[model samples]
Target: MAILATGQPNLEAGQSQSLHYDDFPPLNSCSKLKIGTPRLPIVPSLPNERECKIGLLRNRHVLIGLELQEDFINVMAKNIYYLLAKDGYLYTMKPLIYDAKFKVEEETTLTMAWISFPDLKPTFFVKESIFSLATAVGKPIHLDMATINKTRPSCARVKFQVDLLANFPKFMEMETVNEDTKETKIERVKIHYDRLPRYCLHCKVQGHAEEECRSIHPELHQYVARD
Candidate 1:
């Protein structure tokens, strides 16, 4: 049902070349579709390869004949596990079914899932919880602090704030107390400035006031001198 574009001339465009599914034999199984046929050596019969391909296509809702690497297939299974693991029923049910049905290599798939945790931010809570449970049950986990920090702010915030406070209460001032004390005595004081002399004001000096000035005002000086 899927059409793959081969980037060749179309017969409808009068180039006398067209390629379609009809032109080629139906691949009886996905194993028959090999990668790098002549350039690289052909892959020997990959056990469960067809089931893997079918499972990927079905679970991911992707078209068949989409070229996929082994690593990509592994990653896809892990991602699916991460996405579905939070759903209680799906977590318990689907992985077992998926594992049994697809025959996914557990160590490889779980490792792939763990590595993929950083990329799947939306499912970080579920992934982290699952990881914690696994670690509690004595499963070895390679914790990526940077990846977890990058993905989950809530977890990071709780780690930096609450856990740190719990571990180092003195440093965080968690139990410190503040007390208020009473004061008994009070006093008041007045402030004063030294008085200035009068005549020095007419000469524009700092020690004098204006009222008793010896230097005449300009209008007064003019009238007095005229007199």
Candidate 2:
């Protein structure tokens, strides 16, 4: 008793005719044979009433449906990247022509190299007076005098988180007391930032030198050399 299979043929030499289904080995006979689930493409299901309609306008613009609070919109506009809100409208910062062009503002945190001309004592920058002046440029988050190299004790630096609106003046005025006259005199000291070499003292690595290995606290805040 034999039956010809639709597509499978005999594998023996000189035999080109279709073989019977029974002539083939049974699935149970092959110990290595394994059945697998068929691969199917994933498709997203349609949204229901719980899902608000959200779409893009003009390919790039976003159209958010549902009533939104003013405070929520403002916070979203400010916190989000490359987005701005004006007159109760949320807009993206791409395609410059979409709105009035302006410098996209952001907060920058960094540890900057601070060296006072004549190299005032490391305590000079930490003084309340000097700190106030420093804040005039940026918010002084931390002062790391301990990181100052023993060889370069006068070249200590501080980490500051600055607002974009702050002013980083090239020179700062330092009020000094004259010895003989006992009079107050103002002297200007030139300011330099991020002039130190980037070398990791802990790991002996180049590019990033820190009090501790940056590999451990990779998320620690860093500053831009130019900005």
Candidate 3:
């Protein structure tokens, strides 16, 4: 359940969507995956739509109805997938579970991204341990194949749900104690994001950063500066 929004051409207001379930293609199939993306003549460089299982799924302009897989339901609940579509950006892909209760214009703070923890101990590379470490940032979704199989010992990469509004910490401290001596030492794990979405601290939105948003809120900026 997601409400498709756009920066190029905002979604039309008062547009209503219908919900329908078909008895085909297996139960809980991702339905909106098939909806023909209405052509955007302005965004000429946009690529043709294809099957996409990853969260990079992008759409814009029109309101769309979706029936998502169970695996994706919770993950999409409070997330926005910000993207750059060839010539320009598509702005957002905000999911509509709880947001349905509020005005759809409100932006969600959490967005999905892959983050890496470098030089973590081998024991901590397991899914449970990695997920535990990931909580310092956000909820962990899935682990990369390399991390799962220990093919990549250098670091552990995971798809995570992170709060865009929160100030991100560069490193996490872990206390490790020797089994016999009980001597504890603090270990630091570095956090690296594969991609960071553009978020405006001024507008509290995902579309753009505060510098680009000063035009819209010049008076507000001036007021803050005086303080």
Candidate 4:
């Protein structure tokens, strides 16, 4: 049995003041009873009420009784539908996508590829040179260009620090000027992104996957089932 505390002064301390229930035993079950904090005032039910009200849930719908003279509810409902549509739920026309709220937002260290095709020049893979390319998307924290064994190293590794708000781009384009004409030419370089060893979608943290997440939420199952 659960014991809830009320502000009434006559009730004994640590004693439950609930109506007598038939199932309740004369003695506390296991000689232990759960007690909650002090009870707050009742929530206001009408709009235009200045007083704050605790949120109430009825049939999975939240009712706070806030005042909004405009057609805000309809617009908010449409916005919610669009957000769900991105997951391929009501509208199956578009591909399924994850909501932005579930994205990982930590500063991740990633290796980016800087390549100059057809010609592998060691000068093109210098630390200073790759730093400029990494700066376009992220902070150029470090650079490593000593992995090449060929006469000309077309590919270089750049240690880029970035926050993965969404999926990172696989390919990147860099421009190089010709020696003879001095004209600029664009080179399509590929990015060798590193995946985290484990990622927890429920906690939005690395080093532990969703299956191993300790603080998993009940609503996570609903989102997973929808996906």
Best candidate, TM-score-wise? 3
User: Each candidate: how many clashes?
Assistant: 2, 2, 0, 1
- Candidate 2 global lDDT: 0.34
Q: List the candidate 2 regions with Cα displacement exceeding 4 Å.
A: 1-118, 122-129, 147-151, 177-182, 195-227
Ranking by lDDT: 3, 4, 2, 1
Predicted structure 2: clash tally? 2
**On residues 34-148, what C-alpha lDDT tens digit does candidate 1 reach at each position?**
1111211122222235433332223222212323333233322321222121122222112211222232221111111222222122333332332332221122233345544
RMSD of each predicted structure: 39.2, 34.6, 15.3, 28.6
Candidate 1 off by > 4 Å: 1-133, 137-147, 155-227
lDDT at 32, model 2: 8
Cα lDDT of model 3 by residue, 1-227, tens digit: 21122311111111122223342221111112122333332221112242223222243322322334333434343343333344453444444322232223444555667889886867667766676667677767678889999998998998876777765666766655565675667566677887667787666656688767876757656543563
Q: Distance from true position, residue 113, model 1, in Å?
A: 5.7
Model 4 lDDT per residue over 2-78, tens place: 11123111111111122322321121000000122112232221222343233212222222322331222211211
For candidate 4, the per-residue lDDT at 197 reads 37
The predicted structure with the larger lDDT, 1 or 3, is 3
Cα shift from native, residue 55, model 3 (Å): 20
User: Estimated TM-score per prediction?
Assistant: 0.15, 0.30, 0.54, 0.35
Q: Candidate 2's residue-wise lDDT over 139-220, tens digit each?
A: 4433444533334455545544343323355665555554556676544555555443354545543235465555767777
C-alpha lDDT of candidate 4 relative to the true structure: 0.34
Positional deviation of residue 77's Cα in model 3 after best superposition, in angstroms: 13
Computed on alpha carbons, the lDDT of every model, listed in order, comes to 0.24, 0.34, 0.52, 0.34
